[model samples]
Target: MNQTPQAAIYSPVAQIDALMPDIAAPVDAADFPQTILRFRNDRAAASVGLDSLSDEAWIAHFGRFEPLPGTLPRPLALRYHGHQFRHYNPDIGDGRGFLFAQMRDSDGRLMDLGTKGSGQTPYSRFGDGRLTLKGGVREILATEMLEALGVNTSKTLSIIETGEALERNDEPSPTRGAAMVRLSHSHIRIGSFQRAAFLEDRALLEKLTDYALTHLYGEVPGDNPPAQLLGRVVERTADLAASYMVAGFVHGVLNSDNINVTGESFDYGPWRFTPLWDANFTAAYFDHQGLYAFGRQAEAIHWDVAQLAVSLRALVEAAPLIEQLERFPALYAQAMARRFCWRLGVVPGDGADAMIAAAVRGMAMSGTGIDRFFHDWRGGVAREGHDYDDAAWDAFRGAIAGFAGVEDARRHDYWTDAAPCSMHIEEVEAIWSAIDTDDDWAPLHAKVAAIRRMGAAHSECIAAA
Candidate 1:
C-alpha cells in the first residue's frame, strides 16, 4: 500500500496476489470503439475519494482499463471453478470480467473495484466478452433497490457504454454493449476454495483461509481459523439470504461462482422482485427446473455453505467445518425475524420468527403484493385494505399484535404515499424502454430517487428501533 502526505485514500493492496498469486492471470481489457459515460455513482466515488476525478479520467481508468496510480500494474482476470447447478465444472472462471483494482474506502474497509464485460479472458470459451446496455441498467437498478431494502449488496460504481454491437440469446440480437464496474467487499468466492481443494492445493487453501479471516472477518474468537471462518461466513450468508426473502428479491442465480466469500450479493443477472409472495417463482428465464426458486433461496444458500464446507475439508478436519455449518438454520431464522421487523417498522417479540414466516404464507394466500403487504403493515398498524375474510391474514395479524412500533415511524412522508416503491419486471422494462427508445434517463433517475426516499424512511425506522 502506498500513500501521499495528504492521507491518501486509494491505499492499494494486491490482496488477491498476496493470498493466491497463481490463481489470477494478469490480462488486458478489451479495446472498445467508443467510451461514453452512461452512469457515474458519485456517492460511491466519494467513499473512495474518487469523486473529484473528471469524466475523462474516470473513463481512462474504468472504461479503458488503465491501472490506477499505486494499484496493480495491470488487470487480473481471476480463476476458480464453480458448480453451475450442483455439478462441478472445473473449466469455468472469469470469462467476461476481471479484478481491476483494490483500494480502501473512507471507513478504512478494503473494497475491490471489479469490472464486468471488460474483455475476453482465457476462461471465455465460445463467448465474446461484452455486457448489454440493458444489462448495465438492470444492474444499477438492482443494486439501488437492494441497498434501499437493506440487503448486503455491491454498489454499481460506474457504467461506460463502449460503442459495440453484441449478439446474445438472452435478449434481442445486436444489442448495445457497455462495460460495468462494481464496488464490492470481496472478489473471493466459495468457488475459490473449491478450486484449491479440487486441485489438492493445500498451501493455496491455507493461505485463502487465513486471508479471509484477516481481510474479511477481521478477528475470530477461536484458535481454529477454518472453523471460525466458516462460522462467520455462515452467519453473513444466512443473513444475506434472509435479507433477499424480506426484500421479495430473487437473485435468479445463486451458483457457487456467484456466492462470494463475504456473503455480500453481486454480479446481478436475471434478478427480479416479486409482485406477490410465491415460493415457486423464479427470476431467470432459462431456469426450467426452478432449482433456485424464490422459496428455495435459503435452501440454495445452505447447500452452497455445505459445498463451501466440503472445500474447507482440504484445509482442516471436516468435523469442525460441519459443526460450524450446522449453525446456519438458527442464524437464518434470527436474520429473517430481525429483517422482517425492520421492514414492518415493528419491534420483535415472542413468536417473531414464526410470525414472519406466517406473514409470507399469508401474503400469498391473501393475494397481497409484497411491497403492499409491508406498506400496509408498517408500524404494526394495519391500513384499510387487504382481505379481512382471509384466515391466514387474520392469524398473521394476531401473531404480530404484541409488537410495538418504532416511535415517529409513520411520520415519514414516504409512509403516507399511495404505494411502496418496488422493482417489478414491468417497472424495469418501462425504465429500460425510456432509455432505449428515447435515450431518456429521467425515468431511471426518478425511480432511483423514489427508492432512496423509501430507503431513508426505513433507515430512520431501523435506527430508532
Candidate 2:
C-alpha cells in the first residue's frame, strides 16, 4: 500500500487516514468484465493535474480501481445516519460508493474523488452494488448543467460503461451497467456530524469539527470551533438554497446526507429543472406531500441545517447554534438577490431584493418558463415582444431603475442565438432515447457543448463576483 508516488500529479495527501480513521471501512472494488470510458471531464481533470492520462490509463486508475499514488491505499466506504423525509434511519451508510483518493487542486482546494456504483461494502446489506448506465448519464447531465448555471456542484469526473447488466424496478430491467467518479470540495455531510452525535462521541465530534475548520474554511472570526462551524455551515447552505431557487432547480431529495458541509451540490437522483415557476412543482415521483418542491427547497435545506445544529449542540451550547441558525433567512435572501442579479448581468444595488421579487412576480404572472422570462429580460431590460402583467412590469421597471448592466454579454457568440441552453426533462429524455434505442451519444455530447458555451457567455458574471 506504500506505493511511492511516481510523480507530482499522482501524489495525493493521506489526510483522512492520518486524521479520522474510525468513520470509514476499506473495501475492494468489483472486478468488472470490461471498462469502456464514455465520459471524461478534461477540464475538471486539468484542475487537479490529471489531464495527461491516456484513455487506457484513465480507465485503469478510475475504472479498474487502482489506488492513486501515495493516497488512499484502498477505497473507504463512509458510515453515517441520515433523516430521510424527516424520518431518522440509523442503518444506512455507503452501500455502493467509497472515497478513493484526495488531492489538492491548482487553487489549493482540498478535493475528494469519490466513486458511485463501485462495489459492495460492509453496509451493502441485501442490495447489489451497481448503477444503471442511464442513471450515470443523467448524473453527468445534471452536474454539468448545474455547474454552468452557477451552482456550486460536484464535477462528474469520469463515467465508464461496465460490461454487465443491472436489474432495477425504476427503469427497464436488465439495464446496462456503469460506474461513475465525481470530484468535489468535500465529502463530509451533515449526516456525518449526526452520526457522531448519535453515538455520543464528544471527542470525535470535536475532531471532525476542527478538521472541517482547517480544511474547508480558511479563517474565521470566533474561537469556539463548534459555533463557528455551525455559522459557516448555515451561511453556505443558505447560499446553496438560493442558487437552486434562482436556477429553478428542484433537488427532489434534501436529506441530511445529501447536504455537504461545503454546500456543494451532489448526489443527483430524481432531480429536475422546472420549466415554469410553480410553487408546488415537484421532481421526485414518490414525494406525494411535495416536501421538497421547487418553492420549498429553501425551507427543506433550512430544516436540514437545523438538524446539523442539533448535532452540534452535543459539543456547544444551544444558544450560539440557535444564533447561527437564525442567519439563514437573511443570508438566503441576500444570496437570492445577489445571484439573481448575477444571472441578469446587472449590478447589485440597495433595492436588489425588491427588484428580484418584482422579477419573480412577473415570471409567475406571464405563465412562461422561468428561463424564458430571464432570457427575455436579461440585463434588466424587457424585450419588445415579451410583456408580462403590466402592473408587475411597472414594478420591475421601477425596481430596476438604478441597476446598470454589469457587462455587455450580447457580443458573445452564445447570445447570438434566439434561445439560451435549457435542460428541460423532455430534452433529457430525448438525449437518453437515442442512447437507449440506437446507442447514439451525439445528442448528449452536443448538449454538453452548448451548456459550456452558455457558461462561457456568462463568464464575466461568474468571475466578477
Candidate 3:
C-alpha cells in the first residue's frame, strides 16, 4: 500500500498504471494467424494520454506493479478450484493471469489493473503462458460491445500483439501472440471460495469473505462478524445474476473460477447473447450438455452462490447466508423487470411492460431472430418489409397476441416506423458462425459499429425511461 505523488493529472476516461519494483520472468507472446490483422500502436487507449511504450517498457508495464498515488496492491495468488465441464479440477489459480497492480481512480474507487496472457508462473500448470492474438482481439471487442449494451463488464485498457506462433486446438494453427491489460473491480472468484472449502480452511474462507465485503460491497453496512460478510456477498451475487438475465446474456462458462466475488461480470470466454428463448441455448460448441444455457444462467449463478455459502458454512452461520441467497430469484426478477422497462423504453408503471415479455417470448418461439427482434423493435418494422406499413403492423399485432389479454397489449407498440431495432444486417450469419469458428474479427468490427449507433440512441431513450 505505497503512496506516490499525484503531480500528474488524467481525465475521467483515462487510466494510469504505475510500475512495480520487482520484475518477473518475461513471457513471450505467440504470433497471429495468416488471416489475422495487426494494428501497431504505442499509445494504449485512443482517449488516454499514456505515451507509447517499447517492448521492454511494455513488459515492465504489464509486470506486477506498485499502487499509484493513493491505492493498494495485494498481489497474492488467490486459492480456487472449479468444475470444468462437470469434472472437478482441483488446481487452478491465476495460471496465466496476474494482478499487475491496483490503482485509485479520480473518483476514489479502487480498481484492479491486471494482465492476461503475460507469461507462465509457478501456477502455470502444463500450458503456455501466451494468449493468442485472436483471443486478445476478441476480448477487446467483447468489452466494448458489452459496455455499449449497458452490462457490467471489465474494460480492456491495452492489447499488445507479439510476433510469435504456437499450437492451440481452439484456433487456426496458433500463430498469434498477444497480451491484454484489463480494469476490473475485483478478480477473486467463487472457485477461490471452493478451494478453501475443499481444504476445510475456515480461517482462509473467512479472511477472503472479509476482504471481499470490505472492498467490493462497501455499500452494504454491517460488520456482524462473518455472518454479515457472507450475507453481503450472497446478496450482491444474486443481484449480479439478475443483471445478466435482464441483458439476455449467458456467461457460457460460469465455472467457479469465472464467478467474481465482486459480482461484476468477469472472464469473457465462450460467451454469447441468446437470439432465442430456449432454456438450453449454449454458446460453447463442445458443451454437448447445455450446462451453461441461456435459461439456466440464473440457476448456475445460484448454484455458485450455494457453493460460496458452503464455503462460509464453518466460519459463518449458514442459515442467514441461505436466507439471503434465497432472495436472489425474487430480487433478480424485480431488477430484470426494471431493466426490461428501460431496455424497451417504457416506464415501470407503464402497463405495456407486461405484453412486451410475452411478445418477445412469442417471437423467440416462432423463430424470430433474438438480436434481430430487438433491432427491428427499436425501429418500427416487421419481418416482411423495411417499410412500416399496415401489414407490418399486423405482424406485430399477431406477435402481441401471444401475450394473452388487453392488459399485456399496452406494451406492444414501443416500436414505431421511426426507430427500428435492426441487427447487423450483413453480419447476421457471421454472428452465428463466430461462436463456431476460430476467433474472427470481421463480425466483431461490424457489431461494434452497430453498438456505437445503439449507444447514441440509448442516450436519448435512457432519459425517457
Worst lDDT 10-window in candidate 3: 14-23
lDDT against the true structure, per candidate, is 0.86, 0.84, 0.57
* Model 2 bad stretches (over 4 Å): 1-11, 220-222, 388-392
Q: Once model 3 is optimally superposed onto the true structure by TM-score, how far is the C-alpha of residue 196 displaced, in angstroms?
A: 2.5
lDDT of 2: 0.84
Tens-digit lDDT string for candidate 1 (1-465): 001112336577777768646679888999999999999988777777778889999999989988888778888888898888788999988999999988887767778999999989999998788899999999999999998888888989999999999999878778889999999998999999899999999888888888888877777445788888898889999999999998999999999988988999999999999888899999999889998999999999889988889988877788999888889999998888888888888887778977887787788787889999899888988877644556867778788877898777677789888888989999999999898889999998898888888887787774322
Q: Which candidate is the best by lDDT?
A: 1
Residue 365, model 1: lDDT of: 81
| Model 2 backbone overlap count | 0
TM-score of each: 0.96, 0.95, 0.75
1-465: candidate 3 lDDT, tens digit per residue: 001112223323212121112112223322322222232222223223233444454444543232223333333334468767656788777767676555444344556666677666656889777676667766766666566555667777766655567689875774567777777776777777777778887667666666666556654436554567556566666666755665567778887678787777777777766656567878788878888888788788878777777777777566777777787777677666555544544445433445555555555556765555555544222335544333324445554333322122123333333444333223444553573375554665666565655655544453222
Q: Considering lDDT, where higher is better, how would the candidates rank from best to worst?
A: 1, 2, 3
Candidate 2 per-residue C-alpha lDDT over 220-239 given as tens digits, one digit per residue, 9 for 90 to 100: 43578888988889999999
Candidate 2 Cα deviation (angstroms), residue 352: 1.7
